[model samples]
Target chain A: DAGVTQSPTHLIKTRGQHVTLRCSPISGHKSVSWYQQVLGQGPQFIFQYYEKEERGRGNFPDRFSARQFPNYSSELNVNALLLGDSALYLCASSADSFSYNSPLHFGNGTRLTVT
Target chain B: QQQVKQSPQSLIVQKGGISIINCAYENTAFDYFPWYQQFPGKGPALLIAIRPDVSEKKEGRFTISFNKSAKQFSLHIMDSQPGDSATYFCAAEDDKIIFGKGTRLHILP
Candidate 1:
Protein backbone atom coordinates (compact mmCIF):
# COMPACT_ATOMS: atom_id res chain seq x y z
CA ASP A 1 0.00 0.00 0.00
CA ALA A 2 1.16 3.50 -0.71
CA GLY A 3 2.17 5.72 2.19
CA VAL A 4 0.75 9.18 2.73
CA THR A 5 1.45 11.26 -0.39
CA GLN A 6 1.81 15.03 -0.67
CA SER A 7 1.79 17.23 -3.74
CA PRO A 8 4.01 20.00 -5.06
CA THR A 9 7.08 18.51 -3.42
CA HIS A 10 8.57 21.99 -3.55
CA LEU A 11 7.07 25.46 -3.70
CA ILE A 12 8.32 29.02 -3.64
CA LYS A 13 6.09 31.97 -2.76
CA THR A 14 6.60 35.63 -2.18
CA ARG A 15 5.71 37.47 0.97
CA GLY A 16 2.01 38.42 1.22
CA GLN A 17 1.14 35.72 -1.30
CA HIS A 18 -1.04 32.71 -0.70
CA VAL A 19 -0.11 29.08 -1.18
CA THR A 20 -1.92 25.78 -1.06
CA LEU A 21 -0.40 22.35 -0.36
CA ARG A 22 -2.15 19.05 -0.93
CA CYS A 23 -2.03 15.63 0.72
CA SER A 24 -3.55 12.24 -0.06
CA PRO A 25 -3.78 9.83 2.82
CA ILE A 26 -3.15 6.14 2.71
CA SER A 27 -5.99 3.96 1.57
CA GLY A 28 -8.47 3.10 4.35
CA HIS A 29 -7.31 5.92 6.55
CA LYS A 30 -9.88 8.28 8.02
CA SER A 31 -7.93 10.98 9.85
CA VAL A 32 -5.55 13.53 8.33
CA SER A 33 -3.34 16.02 10.15
CA TRP A 34 -1.01 18.83 9.11
CA TYR A 35 2.26 19.90 10.69
CA GLN A 36 4.94 22.51 10.06
CA GLN A 37 8.65 21.89 10.66
CA VAL A 38 11.08 24.73 10.83
CA LEU A 39 14.78 24.21 10.23
CA GLY A 40 16.47 22.36 13.08
CA GLN A 41 13.15 21.89 14.86
CA GLY A 42 10.54 19.20 15.19
CA PRO A 43 7.17 19.38 13.52
CA GLN A 44 4.47 21.52 15.10
CA PHE A 45 0.87 20.49 14.75
CA ILE A 46 -1.36 22.77 12.69
CA PHE A 47 -4.71 21.12 12.14
CA GLN A 48 -6.27 17.70 12.28
CA TYR A 49 -9.38 16.57 10.41
CA TYR A 50 -11.24 13.38 11.11
CA GLU A 51 -14.21 12.33 9.01
CA LYS A 52 -14.08 15.80 7.43
CA GLU A 53 -14.55 17.55 10.75
CA GLU A 54 -11.97 19.62 12.59
CA ARG A 55 -10.90 17.51 15.55
CA GLY A 56 -7.82 19.41 16.71
CA ARG A 57 -5.91 22.59 16.05
CA GLY A 58 -2.51 23.93 17.05
CA ASN A 59 -1.17 27.38 17.95
CA PHE A 60 -0.89 28.56 14.37
CA PRO A 61 -2.40 31.87 13.28
CA ASP A 62 -5.59 32.51 11.36
CA ARG A 63 -3.51 32.65 8.20
CA PHE A 64 -3.28 28.87 8.32
CA SER A 65 -6.30 26.70 7.56
CA ALA A 66 -6.98 23.18 6.35
CA ARG A 67 -9.85 20.99 5.16
CA GLN A 68 -10.29 17.33 4.40
CA PHE A 69 -12.31 15.91 1.55
CA PRO A 70 -14.62 12.96 1.54
CA ASN A 71 -11.93 10.79 0.01
CA TYR A 72 -9.68 11.65 2.99
CA SER A 73 -7.43 13.93 0.98
CA SER A 74 -6.49 17.26 2.55
CA GLU A 75 -5.41 20.75 1.58
CA LEU A 76 -3.43 23.20 3.70
CA ASN A 77 -3.65 26.88 2.84
CA VAL A 78 -1.52 29.71 4.09
CA ASN A 79 -2.57 33.29 3.43
CA ALA A 80 -0.39 36.39 3.50
CA LEU A 81 2.71 34.29 3.71
CA LEU A 82 5.79 35.60 5.43
CA LEU A 83 9.43 34.61 5.50
CA GLY A 84 8.74 32.84 8.76
CA ASP A 85 6.43 30.55 6.84
CA SER A 86 9.27 28.93 4.93
CA ALA A 87 9.40 25.37 6.19
CA LEU A 88 8.43 21.80 5.39
CA TYR A 89 4.70 21.07 5.64
CA LEU A 90 3.98 17.47 6.55
CA CYS A 91 0.76 15.46 6.37
CA ALA A 92 0.03 12.44 8.53
CA SER A 93 -2.78 9.90 8.51
CA SER A 94 -4.13 7.52 11.11
CA ALA A 95 -6.86 4.94 11.28
CA ASP A 96 -8.87 6.89 13.87
CA SER A 97 -9.00 10.22 15.61
CA PHE A 98 -9.14 9.31 19.29
CA SER A 99 -6.77 6.38 19.47
CA TYR A 100 -3.09 6.92 20.11
CA ASN A 101 -2.47 3.22 19.59
CA SER A 102 -2.86 3.79 15.85
CA PRO A 103 0.47 4.87 14.48
CA LEU A 104 0.55 7.81 12.10
CA HIS A 105 1.86 7.39 8.56
CA PHE A 106 3.50 10.54 7.29
CA GLY A 107 4.25 11.96 3.87
CA ASN A 108 7.64 13.15 2.68
CA GLY A 109 6.24 16.69 3.01
CA THR A 110 6.07 19.78 0.82
CA ARG A 111 9.00 22.13 1.10
CA LEU A 112 7.67 25.69 1.15
CA THR A 113 10.02 28.60 0.65
CA VAL A 114 8.66 32.07 1.22
CA THR A 115 10.80 34.76 -0.34
CA GLN B 1 1.93 20.85 30.02
CA GLN B 2 1.80 19.65 26.44
CA GLN B 3 5.52 20.05 25.84
CA VAL B 4 7.98 17.13 25.40
CA LYS B 5 11.55 17.99 26.27
CA GLN B 6 14.39 16.05 24.57
CA SER B 7 18.17 16.20 24.73
CA PRO B 8 21.01 16.44 23.94
CA GLN B 9 20.66 18.62 20.88
CA SER B 10 23.15 16.39 19.03
CA LEU B 11 25.33 13.32 19.58
CA ILE B 12 28.21 11.43 18.00
CA VAL B 13 28.93 7.78 18.69
CA GLN B 14 31.27 5.18 17.28
CA LYS B 15 30.00 2.25 15.30
CA GLY B 16 29.27 -0.80 17.49
CA GLY B 17 28.67 1.52 20.43
CA ILE B 18 25.34 2.38 21.97
CA SER B 19 23.46 5.62 21.36
CA ILE B 20 21.06 7.00 23.90
CA ILE B 21 18.53 9.84 23.64
CA ASN B 22 16.30 11.11 26.43
CA CYS B 23 12.96 12.89 26.61
CA ALA B 24 10.72 14.13 29.42
CA TYR B 25 7.12 15.24 29.41
CA GLU B 26 4.91 17.12 31.85
CA ASN B 27 1.52 15.88 30.65
CA THR B 28 0.45 12.86 32.63
CA ALA B 29 -2.51 12.43 30.34
CA PHE B 30 -0.26 11.36 27.50
CA ASP B 31 -0.65 7.62 27.26
CA TYR B 32 1.38 6.93 24.14
CA PHE B 33 5.01 7.78 23.53
CA PRO B 34 6.73 7.35 20.18
CA TRP B 35 10.16 7.91 18.69
CA TYR B 36 10.69 8.89 15.07
CA GLN B 37 13.73 8.93 12.80
CA GLN B 38 14.28 11.20 9.84
CA PHE B 39 16.94 11.74 7.22
CA PRO B 40 17.56 14.92 5.33
CA GLY B 41 14.61 15.99 3.17
CA LYS B 42 12.49 13.14 4.45
CA GLY B 43 9.54 12.93 6.80
CA PRO B 44 9.86 11.25 10.17
CA ALA B 45 9.34 7.50 10.28
CA LEU B 46 8.29 5.69 13.44
CA LEU B 47 11.27 3.91 15.01
CA ILE B 48 9.72 2.49 18.14
CA ALA B 49 6.98 3.41 20.58
CA ILE B 50 5.92 2.55 24.10
CA ARG B 51 2.88 2.99 26.32
CA PRO B 52 2.91 4.41 29.81
CA ASP B 53 1.86 1.05 31.18
CA VAL B 54 5.13 -0.59 30.13
CA SER B 55 8.47 0.22 31.66
CA GLU B 56 10.38 -0.85 28.56
CA LYS B 57 9.83 -2.06 25.00
CA LYS B 58 12.37 -3.31 22.51
CA GLU B 59 12.39 -4.10 18.80
CA GLY B 60 15.58 -5.41 17.24
CA ARG B 61 18.31 -2.88 17.93
CA PHE B 62 15.94 -0.19 19.19
CA THR B 63 14.64 0.02 22.72
CA ILE B 64 12.41 2.49 24.55
CA SER B 65 12.80 2.79 28.32
CA PHE B 66 9.83 4.47 29.93
CA ASN B 67 9.88 5.87 33.46
CA LYS B 68 6.30 6.69 34.34
CA SER B 69 7.20 7.78 37.84
CA ALA B 70 9.54 10.54 36.63
CA LYS B 71 7.62 11.22 33.41
CA GLN B 72 10.79 10.53 31.46
CA PHE B 73 11.70 8.20 28.59
CA SER B 74 14.76 7.34 26.54
CA LEU B 75 15.67 5.62 23.28
CA HIS B 76 18.65 3.26 23.02
CA ILE B 77 20.26 2.13 19.80
CA MET B 78 22.37 -0.98 20.11
CA ASP B 79 25.46 -1.51 17.92
CA SER B 80 25.03 1.89 16.37
CA GLN B 81 25.94 2.20 12.72
CA PRO B 82 26.61 5.08 10.40
CA GLY B 83 23.30 4.42 8.72
CA ASP B 84 21.60 5.09 12.05
CA SER B 85 22.80 8.66 11.95
CA ALA B 86 19.84 10.97 11.54
CA THR B 87 17.50 13.23 13.42
CA TYR B 88 15.37 11.60 16.09
CA PHE B 89 12.26 13.00 17.73
CA CYS B 90 10.35 11.89 20.80
CA ALA B 91 6.64 12.64 21.01
CA ALA B 92 3.75 12.28 23.45
CA GLU B 93 0.16 11.73 22.49
CA ASP B 94 -2.91 12.98 24.29
CA ASP B 95 -5.63 14.89 22.45
CA LYS B 96 -2.88 15.66 19.98
CA ILE B 97 0.75 14.70 19.35
CA ILE B 98 3.43 16.93 20.83
CA PHE B 99 7.06 16.54 19.62
CA GLY B 100 10.41 17.48 21.09
CA LYS B 101 12.92 19.80 19.41
CA GLY B 102 14.74 16.70 17.99
CA THR B 103 18.25 15.25 18.40
CA ARG B 104 20.78 14.97 15.59
CA LEU B 105 22.77 11.75 15.93
CA HIS B 106 25.93 10.95 13.98
CA ILE B 107 27.55 7.54 14.25
CA LEU B 108 31.16 7.47 13.08
CA PRO B 109 32.45 4.39 11.39
Candidate 2:
Protein backbone atom coordinates (compact mmCIF):
# COMPACT_ATOMS: atom_id res chain seq x y z
CA ASP A 1 0.00 0.00 0.00
CA ALA A 2 1.21 3.45 -0.84
CA GLY A 3 2.07 5.76 2.04
CA VAL A 4 1.05 9.38 2.31
CA THR A 5 2.16 11.31 -0.79
CA GLN A 6 2.67 15.06 -1.19
CA SER A 7 3.01 17.13 -4.34
CA PRO A 8 5.46 19.75 -5.59
CA THR A 9 8.33 18.32 -3.53
CA HIS A 10 10.07 21.69 -3.89
CA LEU A 11 8.62 25.16 -4.27
CA ILE A 12 10.11 28.62 -4.34
CA LYS A 13 8.05 31.78 -4.00
CA THR A 14 8.45 35.43 -3.13
CA ARG A 15 7.20 37.31 -0.13
CA GLY A 16 3.54 38.32 -0.34
CA GLN A 17 2.87 35.49 -2.75
CA HIS A 18 0.47 32.63 -2.15
CA VAL A 19 1.24 28.91 -2.40
CA THR A 20 -0.74 25.71 -2.23
CA LEU A 21 0.57 22.26 -1.24
CA ARG A 22 -1.29 19.05 -1.79
CA CYS A 23 -1.42 15.70 0.02
CA SER A 24 -2.94 12.29 -0.68
CA PRO A 25 -3.45 10.12 2.37
CA ILE A 26 -2.92 6.42 2.60
CA SER A 27 -5.75 4.26 1.40
CA GLY A 28 -8.42 3.54 4.06
CA HIS A 29 -7.30 6.39 6.26
CA LYS A 30 -9.86 8.97 7.36
CA SER A 31 -7.70 11.60 9.04
CA VAL A 32 -5.23 14.06 7.59
CA SER A 33 -3.08 16.67 9.36
CA TRP A 34 -0.62 19.36 8.32
CA TYR A 35 2.61 20.44 9.99
CA GLN A 36 5.38 22.98 9.41
CA GLN A 37 8.97 22.02 10.13
CA VAL A 38 11.52 24.78 10.29
CA LEU A 39 15.13 23.90 9.60
CA GLY A 40 16.72 22.30 12.67
CA GLN A 41 13.34 22.08 14.41
CA GLY A 42 10.68 19.46 14.83
CA PRO A 43 7.40 19.64 13.01
CA GLN A 44 4.69 21.84 14.50
CA PHE A 45 1.05 21.04 14.04
CA ILE A 46 -1.03 23.34 11.86
CA PHE A 47 -4.39 21.74 11.18
CA GLN A 48 -6.06 18.38 11.45
CA TYR A 49 -9.06 17.16 9.50
CA TYR A 50 -10.98 13.99 10.25
CA GLU A 51 -13.80 12.71 8.14
CA LYS A 52 -13.48 15.93 6.15
CA GLU A 53 -14.14 18.15 9.16
CA GLU A 54 -11.79 20.36 11.10
CA ARG A 55 -11.03 18.49 14.30
CA GLY A 56 -8.02 20.30 15.65
CA ARG A 57 -5.99 23.45 15.04
CA GLY A 58 -2.58 24.70 16.07
CA ASN A 59 -1.13 28.15 16.87
CA PHE A 60 -0.49 29.07 13.25
CA PRO A 61 -1.73 32.40 11.87
CA ASP A 62 -4.92 32.94 9.92
CA ARG A 63 -2.83 33.10 6.76
CA PHE A 64 -2.61 29.32 6.96
CA SER A 65 -5.65 27.27 6.09
CA ALA A 66 -6.39 23.73 5.01
CA ARG A 67 -9.29 21.63 3.81
CA GLN A 68 -9.85 17.92 3.36
CA PHE A 69 -11.70 16.49 0.42
CA PRO A 70 -14.24 13.72 0.40
CA ASN A 71 -11.64 11.47 -1.10
CA TYR A 72 -9.47 12.05 2.01
CA SER A 73 -6.90 14.14 0.19
CA SER A 74 -5.93 17.52 1.60
CA GLU A 75 -4.55 20.89 0.52
CA LEU A 76 -2.67 23.43 2.62
CA ASN A 77 -2.65 27.07 1.56
CA VAL A 78 -0.51 29.90 2.79
CA ASN A 79 -1.39 33.48 1.89
CA ALA A 80 0.84 36.52 1.93
CA LEU A 81 3.85 34.36 2.54
CA LEU A 82 6.88 35.75 4.30
CA LEU A 83 10.48 34.62 4.66
CA GLY A 84 9.48 33.16 8.02
CA ASP A 85 7.12 30.89 6.12
CA SER A 86 9.98 29.10 4.46
CA ALA A 87 10.00 25.54 5.77
CA LEU A 88 9.09 21.95 5.00
CA TYR A 89 5.34 21.38 5.00
CA LEU A 90 4.47 17.86 6.09
CA CYS A 91 1.25 15.92 5.75
CA ALA A 92 0.29 13.04 8.05
CA SER A 93 -2.52 10.53 8.00
CA SER A 94 -4.01 8.04 10.40
CA ALA A 95 -6.87 5.62 10.65
CA ASP A 96 -8.87 8.19 12.62
CA SER A 97 -8.58 11.22 14.89
CA PHE A 98 -9.14 11.90 18.61
CA SER A 99 -7.93 8.38 19.23
CA TYR A 100 -4.62 8.99 20.90
CA ASN A 101 -3.40 5.51 20.11
CA SER A 102 -3.69 5.97 16.36
CA PRO A 103 -0.18 6.51 15.12
CA LEU A 104 0.54 9.08 12.39
CA HIS A 105 2.07 8.21 9.02
CA PHE A 106 3.82 11.13 7.33
CA GLY A 107 4.81 12.18 3.84
CA ASN A 108 8.31 13.23 2.79
CA GLY A 109 6.97 16.82 2.85
CA THR A 110 7.03 19.75 0.46
CA ARG A 111 10.02 22.00 0.85
CA LEU A 112 8.87 25.63 0.61
CA THR A 113 11.43 28.36 0.30
CA VAL A 114 10.16 31.92 0.39
CA THR A 115 12.51 34.42 -1.19
CA GLN B 1 2.87 23.91 29.88
CA GLN B 2 2.56 22.57 26.38
CA GLN B 3 6.24 22.36 25.72
CA VAL B 4 8.24 19.13 25.45
CA LYS B 5 11.91 19.80 26.13
CA GLN B 6 14.55 17.57 24.55
CA SER B 7 18.25 17.61 25.27
CA PRO B 8 21.53 17.15 23.39
CA GLN B 9 20.47 18.85 20.14
CA SER B 10 22.88 16.40 18.50
CA LEU B 11 24.56 13.09 19.34
CA ILE B 12 27.38 10.90 18.10
CA VAL B 13 27.77 7.29 19.15
CA GLN B 14 30.02 4.41 18.18
CA LYS B 15 28.51 1.40 16.54
CA GLY B 16 27.13 -1.19 19.01
CA GLY B 17 27.07 1.49 21.71
CA ILE B 18 24.09 2.98 23.47
CA SER B 19 22.56 6.29 22.40
CA ILE B 20 20.24 8.02 24.80
CA ILE B 21 18.12 11.14 24.30
CA ASN B 22 16.08 12.72 27.06
CA CYS B 23 12.90 14.78 26.94
CA ALA B 24 10.86 16.59 29.55
CA TYR B 25 7.24 17.48 29.00
CA GLU B 26 5.24 20.02 30.98
CA ASN B 27 1.76 18.84 30.17
CA THR B 28 0.72 16.02 32.45
CA ALA B 29 -2.51 15.67 30.56
CA PHE B 30 -0.60 14.18 27.65
CA ASP B 31 -1.55 10.52 27.74
CA TYR B 32 0.90 9.30 25.15
CA PHE B 33 4.59 9.75 24.44
CA PRO B 34 6.00 8.62 21.12
CA TRP B 35 9.41 8.73 19.49
CA TYR B 36 9.91 9.30 15.77
CA GLN B 37 12.88 8.94 13.47
CA GLN B 38 13.38 10.94 10.29
CA PHE B 39 15.97 10.63 7.56
CA PRO B 40 17.07 13.11 4.94
CA GLY B 41 14.35 13.87 2.39
CA LYS B 42 11.89 11.73 4.32
CA GLY B 43 9.18 12.26 6.89
CA PRO B 44 9.43 11.09 10.46
CA ALA B 45 8.54 7.49 11.13
CA LEU B 46 7.18 6.16 14.40
CA LEU B 47 9.89 4.41 16.32
CA ILE B 48 8.32 3.48 19.64
CA ALA B 49 5.70 4.83 21.99
CA ILE B 50 4.56 4.42 25.56
CA ARG B 51 1.48 5.47 27.51
CA PRO B 52 1.44 7.17 30.86
CA ASP B 53 0.34 4.00 32.58
CA VAL B 54 3.49 2.18 31.57
CA SER B 55 6.95 2.93 32.88
CA GLU B 56 8.75 1.42 29.92
CA LYS B 57 8.29 -0.15 26.53
CA LYS B 58 10.82 -1.82 24.32
CA GLU B 59 10.87 -2.79 20.67
CA GLY B 60 13.86 -4.42 19.08
CA ARG B 61 16.85 -2.22 19.94
CA PHE B 62 14.75 0.85 20.85
CA THR B 63 13.27 1.50 24.28
CA ILE B 64 11.21 4.29 25.81
CA SER B 65 11.51 4.96 29.51
CA PHE B 66 8.80 7.14 30.98
CA ASN B 67 8.70 8.74 34.40
CA LYS B 68 5.27 10.20 35.01
CA SER B 69 6.05 11.79 38.35
CA ALA B 70 9.12 13.42 36.93
CA LYS B 71 7.39 14.41 33.71
CA GLN B 72 10.36 13.03 31.81
CA PHE B 73 11.06 10.36 29.19
CA SER B 74 14.01 9.15 27.22
CA LEU B 75 14.76 7.06 24.19
CA HIS B 76 17.42 4.37 24.48
CA ILE B 77 18.91 2.90 21.33
CA MET B 78 20.94 -0.20 22.10
CA ASP B 79 23.37 -1.70 19.63
CA SER B 80 23.28 1.58 17.74
CA GLN B 81 24.11 1.22 14.08
CA PRO B 82 24.93 3.64 11.30
CA GLY B 83 21.51 2.91 9.88
CA ASP B 84 20.07 4.56 12.98
CA SER B 85 21.64 7.90 12.11
CA ALA B 86 18.84 10.44 11.74
CA THR B 87 16.88 13.11 13.53
CA TYR B 88 14.79 11.81 16.41
CA PHE B 89 11.79 13.60 17.86
CA CYS B 90 9.92 13.05 21.11
CA ALA B 91 6.22 13.81 20.96
CA ALA B 92 3.30 14.11 23.33
CA GLU B 93 -0.11 13.24 21.98
CA ASP B 94 -3.55 14.40 22.99
CA ASP B 95 -5.90 15.26 20.14
CA LYS B 96 -2.80 16.22 18.20
CA ILE B 97 0.93 15.65 18.56
CA ILE B 98 3.36 18.11 20.15
CA PHE B 99 6.93 17.40 18.99
CA GLY B 100 10.23 18.26 20.60
CA LYS B 101 12.88 20.34 18.85
CA GLY B 102 14.52 17.10 17.65
CA THR B 103 17.88 15.39 18.26
CA ARG B 104 20.20 14.61 15.37
CA LEU B 105 21.93 11.30 16.05
CA HIS B 106 24.93 10.19 14.03
CA ILE B 107 26.12 6.65 14.65
CA LEU B 108 29.69 5.96 13.62
CA PRO B 109 30.28 3.02 11.35
- Top candidate on DockQ is 2
The CAPRI quality class of candidate 2 comes to: high
Residue-level error in angstroms, candidate 2, position B104: 0.7
Question: What are the per-residue Cα lDDT tens digits for candidate 2 across B27-100?
Answer: 77899899999999999999999999999999999999999999999999999999999999999987778999
> Against the correct fold, how does model 2 do in TM-score?
0.98
Q: How far is candidate 1 from the true structure (C-alpha RMSD, Å)?
A: 1.2
- How much is B68 displaced in model 1, in angstroms? 1.2
The C-alpha stretches of model 1 lying farther than 4 A from their native spots are none
**What's model 2's lDDT at A66?**
96
RMSD of each: 1.2, 1.0
Candidate 1 lDDT, tens digit per residue, A1-115? 8999999999999999999999999999999999999999999999999999999999999999999999999999999999999999999998989545578888999999999
lDDT of 1 by residue, B16-93 (tens): 999999999998999999999999988999889888999999999999999999999999999999999999999998
Poorest 10 consecutive residues of model 2 chain A by lDDT? A94-103
Q: Candidate 2 lDDT, tens digit per residue, A1-115?
A: 9999999999999999999999999999999999999999999999999999999999989999999999999999999999999999999999979545478999999999999
Model-by-model lDDT, in order? Answer: 0.94, 0.94
What 10-residue stretch in candidate 2 chain B is worst by lDDT?
B1-10
